[model samples]
Target: MFANIPTYWCAKCDDITQFSLKVKEPPQFTFAIRKAMDDASGPVIPYETNYCDFCCKNCGQPVRVKYDEHEFAMSSYRYLPKAVYLYEFAL
Candidate 1:
């Protein structure tokens, strides 16, 4: 897991806040596919990615963070729109 916690600008909170991330490991099939790809193409797939879910503690807005294990870096972060969050929860 990545050691550093990332900060994002929270629109609801109106301030930069540190996101408490929860790392999710990739499925076993992902490793199998990666290994097959590597064997076929000589280390083409170097990193196994994991997902991290976080939310703005102040606002309860959810976000998804992606991290790369080999690089030990955060690849990207996406803030879930309020409408989407509400719709999913409503179901």
Candidate 2:
């Protein structure tokens, strides 16, 4: 199993939030997926992504998480719209 947990800095609460990504595939395979995302000529592979929301352990505010076979990212609290830069993980 491959797993990575990264912290995201939240400007709203002035705190850091941690997110997780766990997959059975190896790092090399995930690298290929990210490569395909970067190269339009690369073949497309079907994958499933899921999102889960839970309250922050510290602030008691809702936190949204999005995860796929390769990575995971954290969104803003509750329904508030926010821009989360997730493509950087491809690098």
Candidate 3:
């Protein structure tokens, strides 16, 4: 269900804190633990996304993730609140 399951995310700091798009059913929620890292260069490297969790290194501030799926059949993108931009997220 890769194509059908379009999960979304939002970082608290930068990408240090993150969570995956949940079905919002009963006890339905997924989080992650894969912090981003630099590969030789100072540029940040991307990870194998589509899994639940946040890329800690990438997420730098403080964040609160929430999924906002509009197209239930196509793709989904989480709606990061403005507070997220100023969040002081910690592990």
Candidate 4:
């Protein structure tokens, strides 16, 4: 359902052999993620991000990403990737 949510390339995790789904899908839920990326504070764990890939980092295998709402109150919403569409608004 969340195929339409936009994804941004996680440059930090990309440097590692395995990709991080948690880090990858931050921009989908909130604009703050984008702001954080551009923020000079450096890389921050996107806890406020709504959805997550339930991956087990120990074995280096691809695991199913799940949608968890409680961890992130502000992003406690989900929709099909297409339905929750956004436009490029210049700020």
Alpha-carbon lDDT, every model: 0.42, 0.39, 0.28, 0.33
Q: Rank by lDDT, descending?
A: 1, 2, 4, 3
Backbone clashes in model 2: 0
Writing each residue's lDDT as its tens digit, candidate 4 over 1-91 gives 4344434333334422233333644323345434533342233334432333222234322222333223335646443221111223347
User: Which pairs clash (backbone N, Cα, C closer than 3 Å) in model 1?
Assistant: none
**Which stretches of candidate 4 lie above 4 Å from their native place?**
1-22, 25-50, 68-91
Candidate 3 per-residue C-alpha lDDT over 1-91 given as tens digits, one digit per residue, 9 for 90 to 100: 3233432244333322223444221121123211221111122123212222222335333222322233434454433221121223345
Which candidate order results from sorting by TM-score in descending order? 1, 2, 3, 4
Local accuracy of candidate 1 as per-residue lDDT tens digits, 1-91? 3336666667666866565444332232245443433343332123454434445567655544444445334765433221111101223
> Per-residue CA lDDT of candidate 2, range 4-76, in tens?
4555555556777665533222233355444433352233233444333333345534444444444345532
List pairs with backbone clashes in candidate 2.
none
Which of the two candidates, 1 or 2, achieves a greater TM-score against the reference?
1
Leading candidate by lDDT: 1
Displacement of residue 51 (Cα, Å) in model 4 is 2.6
RMSD of each: 11.8, 15.1, 14.1, 12.6
Model 1 residue 91 lDDT score:
32
Best by TM-score: 1
Q: In model 1, what lDDT does residue 81 have?
A: 22
